[model samples]
Each structure stands twice: as C-alpha cells, then as structure tokens.
Target: MSETHTSPVVLDVWCELQCPDCHQALEDIRALRARYGDRLEIRLRHFPLEKHKHSYAAAQAAEEAAEQGKGWGYAEAVLARTADLASHGEKVLLEVARELGLDAEEIDTALIDGRHTLTVDADHAEGKAIGVTGTPTYVIGDERLDGGQGQEGLRERVEEIADRLLAQG
Candidate 1:
C-alpha cells in the first residue's frame, strides 16, 4: 500500500528580533533547516519582550517583510544587527528593509498605520498563553525548549522531537 503524505511537522520558534539570544539561536535554526529540509516547517513567532524598545516595531516590520516575500531574509538581517537596532531604533528596521530591496515606504506605512500590530500582538498573546516567557523558545508537539536557559542541547532536543513527530506520520 502507498503511504499517505502528511504535512510537515511544525516547529514554532518564539523570537524577539532585537534579542541578542534570538540572534544566537539563528545558528540552531539554520542547523534544523539544513537537517530537516522540507520535512520540518520552522515558524518564527513574534514575542517581543518589553525590555527591547524597538522589538515591537521590528516584529511589525518582519510581518511586512513576509508580505513582501522576504520574511526570513528580513528577519535574519534584523537579528544580525541587534546592537544597531538597540542603538538606532526603528531606523535599523527601515535600513534592513531597504537593504533587502523590500518596500521601505510600505514598511514605514505599515508601522505607522499599525497594520501588522494585530498579528504581532496575537503571536505575543498566544506565546504568553503557551508559557513563552523569553525569546528563542522552541515548541514542537508537546515539547517546549527554552533557548534562553542556554542553547547547550536545545537543538538536539528539538531534533529529537521533530524526528519522532515525522516518524509518527
């Protein structure tokens, strides 16, 4: 009998773009992407901490980037420059949008119009409901790995969960 195809197992990664730890967690995300390829769907969920002044705007910008078909690219660029974001605020977000050849004006309008606020807010609310108190939290199936505690074995844990879920399919 032919095996039925199943949807890829989703790995929800709660992240704050201006978070240094989230930037560090990028390595693990890349590794997972490399390892699972299309078998795993790595989703970036916004969880802008209250401490990061520009995090909320950055999250909105990321949503706009997603609309422009450059979501991950924009996110990686912004995360790579967390320091700049901290120092320069929303300027860094616009800069990254322009650098990625995205519509900077549209992003600016989205920010001002608060178009993506609901999406970011919903993600934040859902994260809080799921016990996400920090950035880079990974949620696969019933497992929740907090990368803030230290990424020591976080990737492996996520891999184990993802592998098991894939096998169950």
Candidate 2:
C-alpha cells in the first residue's frame, strides 16, 4: 500500500511587534519551531493594536523584511527591543534593518510609500474577525489560545493540538 502525505498543520500566531507580551511569547514560538520543525507551519500574522504607536509601521517593516528574505530575523531583532521601539519609533525599525544587512533604504521607502499597508491591514482584519484581541494569540486548527490571558500551559496545549493533527495526517 502506498502512503499518503498530508500538509502540515498551520499555526497562525497573531502578534503585535511593539508589544512586550508578544516579545515574551517568542520563547514559546521558538520552542514550537524546534519541536515540530517541518511538521508544523507557523505563520506570524500582524495585529498591530492602536495602543502601540509604532506597531503598524513595524508590521509594514516586517513585510519589507519578508521581501528581503529576512522576515523572522528582522522581527526577532525588533521584538528583542520593544522598549527601544516604543521610545524611538520608526528609527528603531530602520536601525534593525541596517543591523540585519537588509536594505534599510528600501525598508524606509516601503514604509513611507505604504506599500505594505494593505498586507498589514488584511492581517489585522483577519485577526479581528477571528476574535484575536491581543498579541501572542495562537490559532491552531479550530482552537484560539490567547497568551495575553497567560502564557502558562499555552505551549502544551499547542503541542497537543499539533500532535493530534500530525497523527491524523
């Protein structure tokens, strides 16, 4: 009998770049990536809250980073300094781009031109439609886990769902 291969489970993580809570949730994201590797498809969906002044721009910068093939790297760098981001705003975004060897000018242009606004807006809208009201929200299958409530047991719950999906596959 021939064996069939099913697509990996998609895990959409709703996040706000300027949010400290979302920064903290990076640990769990890394752990999940390490645990599942290719078995789980983890997607970072932007949900820039109005409270964070620079979050919307940061989301657009993240899209520019993706265009440069340094999406996760740029995000991790920016998320590592949420305080700086809050204080310095767009400057911090450009700094991270330069630090990562990405085209800072291009990122700046992308930001000013609002080229990635539609993408960011779309993600935000989808997040809202799915009831994602906070950063670090995890959506696996039909489950929506809000890490804003608490990070405790979130990773375990994600693992359970991922394992079940992989098993079914």
Candidate 3:
C-alpha cells in the first residue's frame, strides 16, 4: 500500500453523535490510528438517525466545533454524554465545545441557525445511497463493515483490511 498509492488508504466512517455504537467504533478507530499512524485516513461522515431527536443538532455542533479545530473533541464529548443530550442537548454541546476551548456561543448560534445542516444531510444521503443501514459503518476499499457495535470481531477484521491495503503499496 505504501508504494502502490501516494495517498493514505481511506477509512470512510459514517457515524452519528448520539449513537453508542458510533462511540465504541470511534474508540476502536483511535486505537487503530495510534497503532498505524498516518498510514490510514479516517474520514468522519455524519449519518444521524431520524430517531435520535438531538442527533442532527449534534452533528451541526460538531461541524461548528470543526471550524475551531475541535471537531473530534466535541464529537467525543457528545458521544460520551449522549444520555444528557435528551433534555439539555444544545446546552451540553455548548459546554463540551467550551471545554475544548471553542466558542460556545458561536457553536450555539450555528446550531440555532442550522449552519451545518446541508453538510449533515448530504452525508446522510450519501450513506443511504450506498446502502448504509446503521451507524459505525466502515467503507474501506471494496469492503463495507456495518454494525460494528459490541462486536469483538471488528478489530481483527479492520486490521486485516488495513494491513492488506498497506501491503498493496
């Protein structure tokens, strides 16, 4: 993979902020990145479920945080505290953004104004177009690994694919 392609292998991760499965998958992805370094490129794509009332808002908050270079941190905070998102969703998101040194009021206003709705909607549409059925779906090479929640098999599976991609170079 190193010599085959000049770019890093893409790990298209379609996830939602309020999904527990997505949170677990994010942890797994962090571990993978730590182990592999820059050899892999993980792209976070929003796929908020319609069932989760605050999920779409959370996605916008994440993007708003991204503008301040805290996208991943905000996402981690939201995913970790998904329970509180029901009643105090926006408040919690702003708190998380502030905790990450981002401007809470800016993010809150973005959420109120729906600044990142198009980005989130486009990702959702793309995910649906590609037959995504749930959160934590991984699109790597020709393989699509879905339903990675609570499964011990994901790590080895991802390792196998990542190694093969790297070997191809």
Candidate 4:
C-alpha cells in the first residue's frame, strides 16, 4: 500500500520567553512554516527556564494574547522586544499585546487571574519529561534539534525531515 500524505508532520517546539535562542529559533520556525506550508504543524510549547525570572509570566502573557487571537504575534513582538523587557519589566508583555491590537487590561487581568499558568506549567512538565533541556528545542517525532538555526537552515532541515516522515507512511 502506498502512503498518502494527508496531514502535516507534527513539529513540537519547546521554548522559554526570555531565551535569546528561543527568540531566534521562533523566526526560523516561522520561515520553516512559510516555506513548507501545511507540510508541518509546529506546536509551541512553553519551557520557561529558571534563570529568567519573568519567563514564566511571559508564557502566561502569551497565552493571554492567544485568548485574544494574537498568541504568536504577541510572542514575536515580545521576543523582538527582549532588550526592552529587561529595563521595562513584564509590563513589556502588555505593551506588546497592545501593539498587536490586543487589550492590555484584559491581558493584565488574565495575568492576575493566572488564567494560563497551568497550561504553561503543563507544557513545562511535558517538555522536561521528553528530555528537553533548553529553549528552542525542536522535536520532530523521535528526532530532536537544539541551537538557534538560521531561517534557511531550519526550513531546509524541517523540510527534509518532514518529507522523509511523510514518505514513510
């Protein structure tokens, strides 16, 4: 029987909000998706590190943005504003939300309510269970990748692996 390519290959990504590696990798992943289109399904999973004090809160903030239909946009904005975040504090999250047309007050309320903490915590625990150790870890089935691969590198790598996975049935 021949294999039918009916669905995208699941690309599980574990990342922290404040990790530079994660920020860079997110762009690469974006490129990967743009190039591959429906061939890949990249799921961003939170893995907030211990060192970045605001990483956990950033995760929740991103989730709150997700509730507002701008999760990735808010995340990308936050990542783009990483430098500002250090000086401006977590309020940078709400600023980014507003920049993305999301309501800062709603995000603030979500943060206060801890609306997405469990989701972030669950992702963190799942990442740890799967042997993820750092930000920007990409798991495609049993294969995993670390480091911040540039845009072309990541798209090419993911394209090659996704093709192989799809071909295998």
Candidate 5:
C-alpha cells in the first residue's frame, strides 16, 4: 500500500443511492470513517446507473438535503429507505424528510422544482473524471476499487491504506 504524506488520503466513493451494493458499501465506509476519523477525507460522488429509474432524483434529493444542512443525515435516511424508494420514490423521500424532522415544504419544493441539479451534475462529472464506471466504486488515495467487495476486503483495504499513510508521516 503506497501512501503520500504531503496530503491526507481521500476516499472518494462513487455510487448510486439505489444500488444494494452501494448501500452496503456505505455502511462499511461509515465504520471505517469513524475508526480512522480525520486521517482520511471521505467523499461521496453519485454514479447513478442507467438501469435504476429513480437514482437521479434520489441523488438530487440528497443534494437538496445538503442545502438544508442535513446532507449526511438525509443520506443515511435515503440509504435506510432504499426499499421504500424502490417501491415509491418521492413518497419515500417525503417520509424520510418527515422522519428526520426536515421542513417538508422546502424539500418538496426543492425536489419537485429540481433545485439541486448543479451539485448533482458536479458530482457526476467528478466521478467521471476519476474513472468510476460502476456503483460502489471507491478511490482510496490514488488507488481505485471499481466494484463491491466483502466487508473484510473493504476493511483490510482501507486499514492497509490508512497504515501506509500514517507510516509516511
């Protein structure tokens, strides 16, 4: 595991919100982030697959949540509500907003009026620049993992990279 000491390692995850693998990978990423804390910077970019019908809207909704100062919370809500979204996209998001105590009127306006397009587009472009071709893809420092892996695989990989970064210091 190679590491560059001059900069913090960036773990950029490129994934669509609707993907099951992406959802699971996020759980692992969250655990790793908690363990490593500020040793790594975790970035999440959207890579909505063509097959998933509601991913784009869902990504936009999360971006709207970011606008409301609840990006992370809204993200977790969306991930947790994936089944609900799969069945009822907008309805699920509204329910999530209510559950999280966000201003439903504002979220409804944002989502229905398409207010978060720029942010979502920027995320998409960034993912493209990093050569992310699939859901649950991760770029740890300069290295990339382009598909889902088991929890142990993810943990070991992240830890190995973290250790290398620390060593470089």
Candidate 6:
C-alpha cells in the first residue's frame, strides 16, 4: 500500500479523559514516546462521550487549564480519576490543577465561568473532521484504529507506517 500524505506519518489519538481504556492507551503511548522520541509525534485530541455527562465540562475545564500551560497535566489528572468526577465533583478538577502547581482559584473560576468552551468546541469539531466517533480512536496516518490495541500491536503498526514514511522521504 502507498502511504502518502502532506503531513508526517504521525499517530493521532482522539480520546476522552473519562474513559479508563483511553487512559490506559495513553499510558502505553507515553511509554512508546519515551522510547521512540521524535520518531513518532503522538497527537492527542478530545472526544468526550455523550453518555459521560461531565465529560464535556471537564474537557472545557482542561482547555482553560491549558491557558495556564497545564492542559496535559489537567488531562492526566482527569484520566487518572475517571471514577471520581461524580463523587468528587468540581473538587476533582480542582485537585488536578493543584497537583499541576496551578492557582486552584483561577482554574475554578475559569471552569465555573465556562471560559474554555470554545477551545473544547474546537477540539470536538476537529475530532469530527478526523472521523473520531469514540473515546479512544486512533489515526495512524490515513488509517484509523477503532479501538485501543496492545502496545506491541501499536508499536508494530507504527514501525510499519514509519518505515513507509521513511521510504517515501
């Protein structure tokens, strides 16, 4: 098969922080990134599920956190405590900000005021354009992986795609 595109042969993961499987998949990808370094550029996007009532809200909150240069940190906390959103409520999000060394009050204000709605909306639109229909869909170049596969499976696939990209170059 011919692997061709204007962009690099990168892996794009569209995930929801509320999904445990997505969290696991992201952990695996983080390890892979550490090992492979610049060979793979793993891009993360938001694909909050509709069933998770607080997911959109959380995504927006994370986006606001990003304004303070803590998006990934907030996302990590969200993924880590997927089960706590309901019981912990806004406290869970606040804890994430605190852990990331952010001003908790500022994050809370941003979340309450719905400051990052547009950023999250942009992520939603981008996810739709890329055919992201689930919490943890992956796009390997032009190929889409519907579910989170094992590390070996993902690595092998990435190697194949990287080989093709290298050949094209």
User: Which residue pairs overlap in candidate 4's backbone?
Assistant: none
Residue 26 in model 1: lDDT: 92
The global C-alpha lDDT for each of the candidates, from Candidate 1 onward, is 0.95, 0.94, 0.84, 0.80, 0.77, 0.75
Per-residue lDDT for 66-128 in model 3, tens only? 888877778888888888887776688888887788899999899888889999999999999
Candidate order by lDDT, decreasing, is 1, 2, 3, 4, 5, 6
* lDDT-superior candidate, 2 or 3: 2
Candidate that scores best on lDDT: 1
lDDT of 4: 0.80
Regions more than 4 Å wrong, model 2: none
lDDT of 1 by residue, 10-81 (tens): 999999999999999999999999999999998989999999999999999999999999999999999999
Cα lDDT tens digits, model 2, 78-162, are 9999999999899999999999999999999999999999999999999999899998899999999999888999999999999
User: What clash count goes with each model?
Assistant: 0, 0, 5, 0, 0, 0
Model 3 steric clash total? 5
**Candidate 5: misplaced stretches above 4 Å?**
1-8, 149-152
RMSD of 4: 2.7
Task: List, residue by residue over 1-169, the lDDT tens digit for candidate 6.
Answer: 9775544457777878787777777666776577667767777677778887778778877777777888766787788898998566668888888878888888778877887777777878988987777767777767877664443476566667766775775
Which has the higher lDDT value, candidate number 2 or candidate number 6?
2
* lDDT for model 3: 0.84
lDDT of 3 at 129: 93
